[model samples]
Target: MVLFQEGLRIKMKDLQNTLEDYEQVKLSCDHTAEYIKVQSNNTEKQIKEDFEKLHQFLRDEEAARISALWKEEGQKSRMMKEKIEQMVREISSLSDSIRVVKEKMGADDVSLLQNYKSTLERAQCALQNPERVSGALINVAKHLGNLKFRVWEKM
Candidate 1:
């Protein structure tokens, strides 16, 4: 009966060691799970932050392009205005010359004919080649190709 008790003690100790090993494995598993959860959360936060930065970058780029477009439009408008003023001045000059010619109806035929020929030539030139003042065309799609590539690289 004492030998049986000694054998029982050895079995109990072995079971205890096995239980301790099992507890250690469970603890390690729990720690690994927690570590994975923290890493996952961190990765998600990093992705969100990157997306925010990318969105802001897009906004800034859009604003800059819009500003440039507006500036170009303003310049085009000013240039058109200047061209119109020049044309108006030219028309006024022609009108004044016509009035002078009418008043000098008794002037030499050669002088009047020469003046009319010069005026006709000027009018023809103006008609054939009009002043081309068009607004700037903002190409929004021009940057889209590079934009996709850049966004993909960020991802």
Candidate 2:
């Protein structure tokens, strides 16, 4: 019976030590969990801030592109208008020459005939020589190639 009591006392001590060790382990686990949670929160906050900065940069870039497009469009429009006006003036001058030639059809004026021939040549040359205007254009294929890479690098 005395040997059995000593064994029981040893088992109780072992149980007490186990309980204390378990509490210490649990405390350590809780601390680690809290630390992970704080780190996760910080990482989340940083990602959100980076995302906001990227969003703002994209917005500003879009605005700048739109503004530049508008300015280019206005410039092209003005150029087209000027070209049309010049064409109208040329047509008017040609029409006047045609009328004068028709009036001089029966007249035996050598100087008038030469003038009409010169005017006719001028009109033919103007018709043959057309002005070509190449307007502004966006290259989507080229831009898309570097777009993803540029954004990723920025991040």
Candidate 3:
């Protein structure tokens, strides 16, 4: 159980860092959305950069946790179960925020953001079953990558 506990600690630290990145990205998005409302082109580019950074951070964090889970516990631990649940909740909240931001951005950018929002939601739901986390993470990563592409295209 010592290894499991150590793994859990590492996972928890990664999760905390991921959550921090998400929060920072959300804040940047909020600020950029407001700037966009006033038609600030310069701020738009900065916002896109922020989003990309957030995506990279999340991808790295997810990959680390997934690798650790697969190697150490194979997703059988109760701690892993709880961590998944927590991650789901965090992702769900982030998705909701993204949706709101999309709505504010209007119809042109709405589709891509909405797609990302839904993908995150799906990832959140997939956490309940360990077998699904890998697939869900792939989907989420794809969506986030697409989101970065779309945002950059706009800039």
Candidate 4:
């Protein structure tokens, strides 16, 4: 009976260790997702700023009919496009890394990564189309306001 109790204790300790390992893996995944979200936000902001600046430059009368202005604007636009492409590549690579890590943790955790993946895709899409993004944001805000009103009425 003494030896049997000792075996049971060892098994319990092993199970505890496994649970701790899984928890650590989960935490790491969560951290990675947060980092990706932050990076996406920063990239989106940069892209939107660049696009607005380019649009403003194109609209400026002073920039009109000036060859140098055209060249400068072209260069700036190219640079912004390159940066956007690089950000997209980095986002894709990070997603691949996340998938690998998830697989290492366990195939069953794939669903857990879906929200992260969806958010990343949304960020990328918004960066690609600012006008559409702005419209979508407006719609979302309107919906949120309606929901809040409904909740307040219920209360």
Candidate 5:
């Protein structure tokens, strides 16, 4: 009977040890699951931050391009304005010369002859013919050519 008791005690101890081992395995599984969850969240955060940087880069690129476009527009506008102002001055000068000649024509013969050379020179303006301004507009091709490809390449 004592032998039977001894066997029973040993069996009980073995079962307890098994139970403890099972509990340890369960704890390890839970820990592994929590670690995986934490790691996944960290990876997702890193990816989001990377994308935000990309978006910021694109925004900065867009701002720079738009600023350049505006600068080009202002430069071209100023050039055209200067050309137009020059043409207007030339026209005003021509009109003044015509008026002087007409007034001289109304004068008496001796007075007209006295200023004939000066009047003729006034009639012959030294201005050259206005030439067309080449490359006066914004170069759209420089801004827009292969836009997506260029951006991707830059990125």
Candidate 6:
């Protein structure tokens, strides 16, 4: 009977210890869950911040590129316009020269002989042909080539 009582006491102590340990485990599990939640929130915020920074940089880069492209387009277009205007002026001058030659030809023989020297000089157009406008167009290749790779490399 005494040994039975002793054994019962030991079993009661063991149960108490187990219950305490179980409580400790539960507390630890709760702590772990809360820790994970906090960590996950922090990670999410950091990821968003990092992406926002990258996005802002890309936006600024895009704006700068578009501005540069527009500026180049304007400059090249202006250059072409000036070249065309110069060509028109040259054509007008050539037309006037032809009219003068025809007038001189229609003159009498005496007038023709007297003005022959000047007429001949005027007949020979001294105007040099306009130089070919090389690279007068906007260089799209330079802007678009490896664009993604360039942005990644910058990052």
Taking every candidate in turn, the Cα RMSD to the unseen true structure, in Å, is 6.1, 4.8, 42.2, 41.8, 4.2, 2.8
Please, what are the lDDT tens digits per residue for candidate 3 over residues 1-155? Answer: 99999999999999999999999999999998997877776678889999998788768766765675565554345555776897788777767766765554565656656666654454453333334434223233533457556555645
lDDT of each: 0.74, 0.75, 0.67, 0.64, 0.92, 0.95
lDDT of 5 by residue, 25-122 (tens): 99999999999999999999999999999999899888888898999999999999999999899889888989998998889999999999998898
Best by TM-score: 6
Report the lDDT tens digits of candidate 2 across residue range 88-121.
8877877876776566665667865767776456
How many steric clashes does model 3 contain? Answer: 0
Q: By summed lDDT, which 10 consecutive residues of candidate 2 come out lowest? A: 135-144
Q: Candidate 2's C-alpha lDDT?
A: 0.75
Tens digit of lDDT per residue, candidate 4, span 51-109?
Answer: 88766755552334345445655766676677678878867876776676555445345
Residue 28, candidate 4: C-alpha displacement in angstroms: 1.6
Q: Relative to the unseen true structure, what is the C-alpha lDDT of residue 118 in candidate 6, on a scale of 0 to 100? A: 99
Order the candidates by TM-score, highest first: 6, 5, 2, 1, 4, 3
Off by over 4 Å in 1: 1-5, 88-155
TM-scores vs. true structure, each candidate: 0.57, 0.67, 0.25, 0.38, 0.69, 0.79
Provide the global lDDT of candidate 4 against the true structure. 0.64
TM-score of 1: 0.57
Candidate 1 per-residue lDDT, tens place, 15-73, comes to 99999999999999999999999999999999999999989987877786668667866
* Residue pairs with backbone overlap in model 3: none
Error of 5 at 62 (Å): 1.4
Cα deviation of 3 in candidate 4 (Å)? Answer: 1.6
User: Where does candidate 6 clash, by residue pair?
Assistant: none
